[model samples]
Target: MCVRYLGFVLLVWFTGVLRAQSAALHCGAPSLSGGYLVPEQETYSHESELTYACDNGRKPAVEGWWATSTCQNGKWSHEPQCIDEKACIPPTIPNAKYTEKLNGWYEEGHKIRITCDEGYEQKDQDATAECINGIWTSVPVCERSTQACGEPPKIPHAVIIHQEYQEVFAVDSELQYECEDGYTVEEADGKKSIFCIAGSWTKGPTCRIRPGTGLGGSTVGGTHGGHTTSTGSGTQPASGGGGIRPGTGLGGSTVGGTHGGHTTSTGSGTQPASGGGGTGPLTRHVSNCGKPPIVPNGEVLETNRLFLKYRCGTFYKLMGPETVVCYSDGTWSEVPTCRVAYCAVDTDEYPDLKHAGVKYIKDGESLRFECVDLWLVTNYSEGRCTDGRMTFTRCCNKFQLNTNIC
Candidate 1:
């Protein structure tokens, strides 16, 4: 299709003298399925169809691309092209093997058959995967079968208190165990035991104890204590329990972000984010975006909110907003970044472009493109340089090579 279009374009250019004659305007051939559709005769006159019947494995790249051309005055009505059936790479499936009779490449209409190995089952009932365009429509899955618990798990520093236990136990069996000296169950209502159930084992309790004291605590879960013993002037009552049971006098311990918002114990109930009728001031929840996202060649600004502002270095202008706000939900808004102010123009787009410009331009500067000779700007031939990004629009020989219009 491209060759035929180029041929017509070249013919029209060579027959420049015939432009004044009553010759039909040529149509640029468009790529169809994957084949070429040239006119039957050189006389591209009125109504005609550049026809070609594609093979079984091939189909049109786009819907209803076929069109008959009718020369309305001096131009052809439609572009000529055909669709090409491209092949798709085979998909990889875990624990599944493809059938031996697989083709080298799965064409558009081809199908791939996969079977799960022994002791494995398909994720879905569909065993056949189709190749649509360059991607596989869908792939089957195979996963290992799950079974009940094989043996009773042994606990560290503790033994099962229940007697009716065996090597291999049934599912959903709840066992009882107690922690030994210097150690105690941190979670599970302050009890030491694990339930025989899927998805819950991953969250099994840990034997925890307080630091410097026998009582233990796990810092993995929860935040400010929900129900506290008290709320002193310097201590803030925690709403999210940091551990299973509240330890003794957790005074001067700050919660949330590291902005000096400490919580104290004075035997009290829960406190809200704002004023909660307690002697302790409203604990400001600082935004902890984890190792604040760094902006290239930029410095962060000081702000009491969850987020910070970033500004580019000298000679560099900000590409986006400068301020990042820290929200009340213990999260920070998206951080703005800075980049180099150097911008480059793509000269390959304009075949007949002429300019005495360098490869890169300074920030906030515009490049001039001469609109003389065979080059035509049609009112535009300049581009601005900002944040290492260039927006250029240049026209050549009355044709738009590349432009950033609108």
Candidate 2:
């Protein structure tokens, strides 16, 4: 230990001595005072410096310790430093039921499951609790089952076997009722025709019966015959046979009594009963003999426009007034009124002279013409008129003959 100390002290002294010697050597430039003094006369000041470092959690170790000095100064006095220590730690969540099952720390990416207690059903799937930042997500609740049917139905003439029945009933269980013998049975729409299906009973049906006499044609009582009977008065008994008198002279009378009247017969007549005169043969007379011949009102002047009219006894066409039909008595039907058919005259200057006087040329009418001794006349031969327009073929007169006439 003493040798080490001696070495450190020697090193310090050597360094100081070198600096002092360097300070004493004023070689090239003159001093600001303009005095040519030896380097041994120069003076030097010590400098202070600092370095930075950090401890556990502190700030800078040193503050405000730095200086500049001449090269002849001793080693730096002291170095400054800083101390800093910082770290991050995780957060904690409280009262989380299933969070503990997630290893140890609940960090950003942790997950956990949540479920309802027994006898309770979850509306959705089991939820997952996520550790977002530091808090656990909310847990969902469970719900219970619901009832099916709405209300019990009403039944007529028959009473329900039990009151306040369950909302759901089992299948194939029948509902029975009793009605009077003469009445019929009926039911309501939905509930009345209800059949047992699946686990629950459909709505109950209503009961009814028709009101009338009983079956077997009896009127409320079981009697087959009645005691009251009808009788006739002053006339032959309706139950037995009898005869009719000869001179009764009833229209419907026969040797026996008339159908609706009583009869009386005696043994005193001497002359044989004169037979009634035989009914004469039925006869009919003829009058107003021989039908008269029908005379037409007038004769048709225009053959194309003639219309016929018939007499009273004559038969004619049942439809239009234009047609005439003969009667069964061999006579022509009366003639209807007649009118002239007038047509418009065509005045177009046709090139063909032969078709000049033709009036109202119908469809499909055609004509050809030739010039007489023409001096080479053109557009004169083939021509036609359709819909009041003239179409003519090209023609020219080739020669001249007689100057007076052809």
Candidate 3:
């Protein structure tokens, strides 16, 4: 039989007939089984069925249509099996190494850790690793550890007190010094004792005081002149001196009118006996007369004739014949006169006086006036010098008497 349906051709024949017939079909080979015939059309035809078997120890394929042979009598064709096409697998990080790979079936946010060996230090990320493509992006590096000391101690003029003598130092441990005997020990600038924190001390010394001489007296006692002597004896000379005869003076000679012992004068003006050496007067002759004069009560001593004069709170030497007499009150009798002893007179004279008594002028001349104080002369500028017959003008304001005049 021959049937055409939807442009596809199907050949119908018995199973045995189809097996024995040698026919050529274009779309696909014809299938004959029992009374039914199934035609293999182009759309449904299996060209060359591939049998699928997973390699590399992959999961086995499922049995149904994907695994069952398709042809009825002829050799059944196997179907292609479903495979895992995912190329990305979680990247592995070696025990001590870190990975940055991101490829994996793991959900996002998966992480891993990486670390270094005992003496080594991790240079890269030591905490977390990320999943990326099938391979890790980067491997972490491990390096050797480094040892270092902190800043050196700030001590000056002092040495560290430790066996190591390292640059860094701790607190509470001290730095020592070597000072002279009399001087005291003290801390150096900008430094303190080391603690147990980070460093140790090395070596240090202490301060001592220096001996000296001071203005205060020495420990041993002596006089300011540094001399020591016994009673009735002079101080020993710094150099040796010859011994003198027992009762003799400086020259070892017999004294006085007697034959042997030294003699010293006891009277105010007497000299030592001639034959014995004697110390002469060491002072000059001074008279108390030239010193300030002592004034006795009711008596007057004229200082103008003497050498010294006394005034208010001061003593002065008399340079000329100015008289300064002493009074009963120990004060000078005369008021201090400011006038010079000698003076020359010119043609100009003093205003004329009209007093009847004698008028003495400072120039050592005297005249008799008929008028007294406040009286003016009638002759205007000149006046008669008579015994008692002088005429006068009336008193005026310009010729008024000066009450304070001495």
Candidate 4:
């Protein structure tokens, strides 16, 4: 102890200034991530330990979690941490689809709810997947319901220009398309169609765009607010009854937020659509996009701008479109895909440890670990395959379950 500290303490004691001194070894209540601590303390004199537990919908990510932290001299020996509750991956089955898209990937303590597609029925089973400990417990399969064509596949940068009232594309039925502005149909093969041949539709042509129409030359309206301007300078059109020339339009999303609509120049009184649209109260129009994109083994995880968040199935990770915009023009900003994955565990590392299920687990797959009889486990017994990795608790078993090695 420093002489100054002792002198100050003596002065305070004699003057009664130490009367307001607080309890010894006072500390803030134990703080933990994804969980809370039991028996939070305000003051401590002797060494104490804290018990930790994950909150509802959360689980421990790593194995061998200590579950407790020690407090000594007002300082914690180690911090307690736990994983957030996870959800199961989207259920996958051939000739089937989710009844409704989900907002996020499956997680621990959550369930997958869905139904079979039209003309298809469950082969005497339920369409559900349970999320257990950050892994899917089971996946449902859907058999063929009908032989006719299911929903036509979605084409990027394009939409269904024509369809019947029933929307059923029966055998020999045909679907046509007209690409959105700034995008054009495949002119090479000239196959912009969906022909319901037999039970499946032929490969549909994709839409293509160059990204910009007019760049350098002054545009009637700049790309600031997704508006089109009429290129004019108080001049008349060419001798051929030329009115004001149309200005270049912007593509993708505009700064001012108008989309899935057309941009025309209102120059020279020849046209009257570019004089800055009305500022009157806007009326809500029906969404052009038919619900959000439901990618194969994925769902609309979140709604951002027009861009959406697409979460892949359990074990699988997303390849593209972390953000997408739902267009008012009945088109997807950019759809995403979910790629299959393999587990990230190294089986060779655990000698004498036996595992069942996939020797090398795949994403969304699970494996069980166990020790020989008379032996005990120090780490988690199960591992869930997710995104090329496994989230498991630590294991260290050098002794028997009920008896210590002495």
TM-scores, one per candidate: 0.23, 0.15, 0.14, 0.25
lDDT of 2: 0.33
RMSD of each: 29.1, 48.0, 51.5, 25.1
The sequence of per-residue lDDT tens digits that candidate 2 reaches over residues 224-343 is 212211222211211112222346543111121122221212222112133444342211111111122222222222222112333221111122243343321223343343221212
Best candidate, TM-score? 4
- Where is model 2 poorest over a 10-residue stretch in terms of lDDT? 281-290
Model 1 scores a TM of 0.23
Score each candidate by Cα lDDT.
Answer: 0.50, 0.33, 0.31, 0.51
Better of 1 and 4 by TM-score: 4
Q: Judged by lDDT against the true structure, how good is candidate 1? A: 0.50
Q: Which scores better on TM-score, 2 or 4?
A: 4
Which window of 10 residues has the lowest lDDT sum in candidate 1?
196-205
Order of models, best lDDT first:
4, 1, 2, 3
Segments in model 4 whose C-alpha atoms lie over 4 Å from true places? 1-286, 289-294, 301-309, 326-330, 341-351, 359-368, 373-406
| Candidate 1 ranges beyond 4 A from true positions | 1-291, 296-298, 301-307, 312-321, 325-333, 337-343, 355-365, 370-381, 384-406
